[model samples]
Target chain A: MPSLLILMPLAGIMILNFAFGRTMKRSAFWFAVVLFLIQIILAIFHHPVFWSNELEMVDRFFNVSFSMDYISFIALLSIGIVSLVSLLVARCSIDNEEDRFNFINLLVIASIGMSGIVMVKDVFSLYVFLEITAAASFILIAFWRKRRALEGAFKYILLSAIATIMMLTAIALLIVLAGDPSFSVIKSALGRSSSSFMVTLAVGIFICGLFIKGGLVPFHGWLPDAYSSAPAPVAILLAGIVTKVVGIYTIMRVMISLFGFSASMGRVFMFIGALSILVGAFAALGQRDFKRMLAYSSISQIGYILLGFGTGTTIGILGAVFHFFNHAIFKSLLFVNSAAVEDSVGTTDMDKMGGLASRMPITGATSVIALLSACGIPPLAGFWSKLIIILALWKSGHVAYTLIAVFASVLTLAYLLSMQRRTFFGKLADGLEDIKEAHTRIRVASIILAAITVLVGVFFPLMFDNFILPVKDILLR
Target chain B: MNELYWRIFLNFSFFIIMLFIAGFYCILVTRNLIRVMIGLELLIKAVTLFLVVACYVSGQAALGQALIITLIVMEVVMIAVLAGVVLSIYRHNNSLDARRLRELKG
Candidate 1:
């Protein structure tokens, strides 16, 4: 059953807690590792025996109807991969056994929530799962109970609450017009009411909610704080998949399925996407903290995804989804590098360290690969996706937007390379000598992510038919 | 839209807007962490009311009520977590001022 994708992890958590409390705590990492691996395997292979079956009993009890497509497949794959990487980071970084146990539970809960997000067809179920993910993230952000983390969590809480309210209001409006919560019902309702002012107002409110969730410009004030102050593993989870799934993916799905991608909507998306790119790039240029800089870089990357998807063309959406996957992997790899640096050098302030590449060879090297991919350098996964987006924009006759995308890419290269040189390429900054590479698990995470990035880029031709073609079917739907 | 439903919306919207103004104003002005949480609660309260009225207007009270129940449950969990976070912030700084929470700035 498709619902098993969500239920399986939930079952793991329940078993972890009541099955054998303290004893299970020690084995929690392995349990989570196995669980995520299964999800990864299922998503990649698309096992028909598991996917084709359905449990009428469970479906009726939950009253949810889920349908899977290429979009959900891509989202599920990323969720599993990012969660697995985050798990490894947590295994090494969090020392306290109880704390680690709690973190594991939250990670699994988040996994279940995200899985629910990708699979659900009803908007109310979508809202429920979004809150589940958000709640788990709030606790995860405040896991350390440090001052910065708590503050960050508070800001996220307040903003997330506001975003929820906006979305609920929109949902209510849609239900009033459509009299149902299912995508098909609401979509038909929206189509019939397309000329109504209230239709425009509802769409506006809903998109605004998504923008806040996605951390787009004007609604991104809470994002950098939540991201930079979060613990390393939590940072990876939040940055890699959580916000993307909630904000950007929802925008894609809802616009395609419900609002039908109006021209005005497309224009609004392009304008805001461009704004986020310029603003996030300019802001990152001044940040000194390594994690903070990565956080801003993340905003800029999100702009690329948005800009591509905004084109509202099949090729453009294909590019956006591919870029989403690429961003998740490379960004996670970069965060893993930051975690490694923080573990050894005891700071994220980029100004403090230099020439450390000699010491942390694996992290330094993998980070180079990641940064290069992020800059859309040749033969990397980022290049192909970016090329597709630019091509789509050009074909659509949006020459100005196409140029803006290219210029911002140059900006991406500039900020990232400069930060990299300051942190890894200069003379060792007065730190005498004693430092070591990150833990084994961390290096393992770095290697795995870097491998995916390089392999996807290298095997682009073979994988595109397997991956990108499926995404085009979403537009067809 | 039905005429009765449109009239109901026109009447209910005034109270909803008032509640939203009150909630947002409180959130923007309040420095105390607890009050901030309270402001969040106010916003949610307004949303809940709004959802109910919308359901009534559409004559789909069943789905709307079910959603409200779920939302209430979710809201409680959220508030409880916020309270815990607020308590931690208080312990760290011995105060709940939002200004003290600005250490993460650029």
Candidate 2:
């Protein structure tokens, strides 16, 4: 089954982990990587790709369906690639063996839940999968079992629980009023004549919950803590795929498929996206910890994607997907690279160390590439994506938003460049001569993602046409 | 008049609301990590109840009930495992107030 292709990695991990609880770190890590590789192969090679029927179970109150299509394929590919790289990067912290094993299993579980949520057509099924992903993330954040780790997990759990409940209650109301959850059925029920009050009430609650999950501005209290505390590999998965998949991807899918781009809704999304961009970028500028800064940067980056989608043009949606793909690669690269830096320097405090390029060339070079890609620098992945989004804004005739986006992109570059300077250049601080390069697997992971970032930038059209265009068409339709 | 159905709906709604309030109170007031988790379990149970009752009222019992029960089982299993994890945290950290373990601050 197509579902199995996404789920098999989690199953494989469960077997290997539970049966061979004492397996060597290298074996466990390789086993997970190999499993993901097999998944990637199956995802690419499977012919006549069997999309499962929309399995539906209808009751008076709930109509549920599990459906997969081209959109699900996009999510699957992202999950497979990002998670494999994250796992390889996690192996450098050899001291936390048990935590590493647990983190790998949780990553697999979250990936399965994410892919499942994207594929499922029913709102209720989406809620269930969302919870699964959240729970897995909570456990993974607390994997380190430090004071901060538990605290971060607790905060994340509490906030996510509230958001999930809001989503569930909204679904309940939608089902009670509309009688079904299938995309086609719901849209028909919401036909051109539905009362504005009911529509507003329902849509507002749903969007608020989704915004919280996406870590947009006011609801982003848990993000910096969770991202900074989570193990580097797990952080990569969360930043790269988890937040985007369950939150932004689902919101975009549901709004386009069910709600249509009502003028009021579009304006609200645009405003929220803009606010998130400004707030997230400014907030990130002050962070001292590398991971924490990256966390805030993710929130800002997601704002651009949201802004692109909110523009409601075909070009706009395509640009959003392009940005999403680009962000996933570079952000994951940055997180893993931070792990490498931490592994070598014994700390993530950017100001405490310097001259890392001379010490750890791989981490320094790869990180610079990632940093450049993140800041929309030329000939890198971020630039094309940012250009597309800005062009989309201009074409949409939202000149003000276009200007704001350009401004945000520049601020993004400034802060990121400063971060790079503080961490990599200048004189080495006291007691730093003994530091070495990251573990073999960690370096391999960084180089792979770094290379992909450059390749995707150079061959933008190929990736855009083959990978992003189909998903964009599906969502836009 | 469909009085019986209306009464069932009101009863279930009251029960779900009460469970939610209790869970909120526990999350807000409790100091123990285990208790906090119990509060979460209670909240999830309330959600499940709400879903199932909503399905029944709307006359769609089969799918919702199945999904709710599946959710209940998942919560139970996951909560039990997490309870063990919390206990370990308490052992190592020497407190479960969840407020004291502030080691990873920025």
* Candidate No. with top DockQ: 1
lDDT of 2 by residue, A102-203 (tens): 777777778778877877767877777888888888887777676666667777776777787777767766765566766777777777535667677777
Q: Residue A257 CA error for candidate 1 (Å)? A: 1.3
TM-score (chain A only) of candidate 1: 0.98
> Among all windows of ten consecutive residues in candidate 1 chain B, which has the lowest summed lDDT?
B56-65
Give the range of the ten consecutive residues with the poorest summed lDDT in model 2 chain A. A53-62
Measured with C-alpha atoms, the lDDT of residue A270 in candidate 2 is 82
Model 2 chain B weakest lDDT span, ten residues long: B76-85
The clash tally of candidate 1 reads: 0
Alpha-carbon DockQ of candidate 1: 0.88
lDDT of 1 by residue, A32-143 (tens): 9998998989889887677777788997887656778788888899999999999999998999999899999999999899998888787888899999999999999999
Model 1 stretches astray by more than 4 angstroms: none
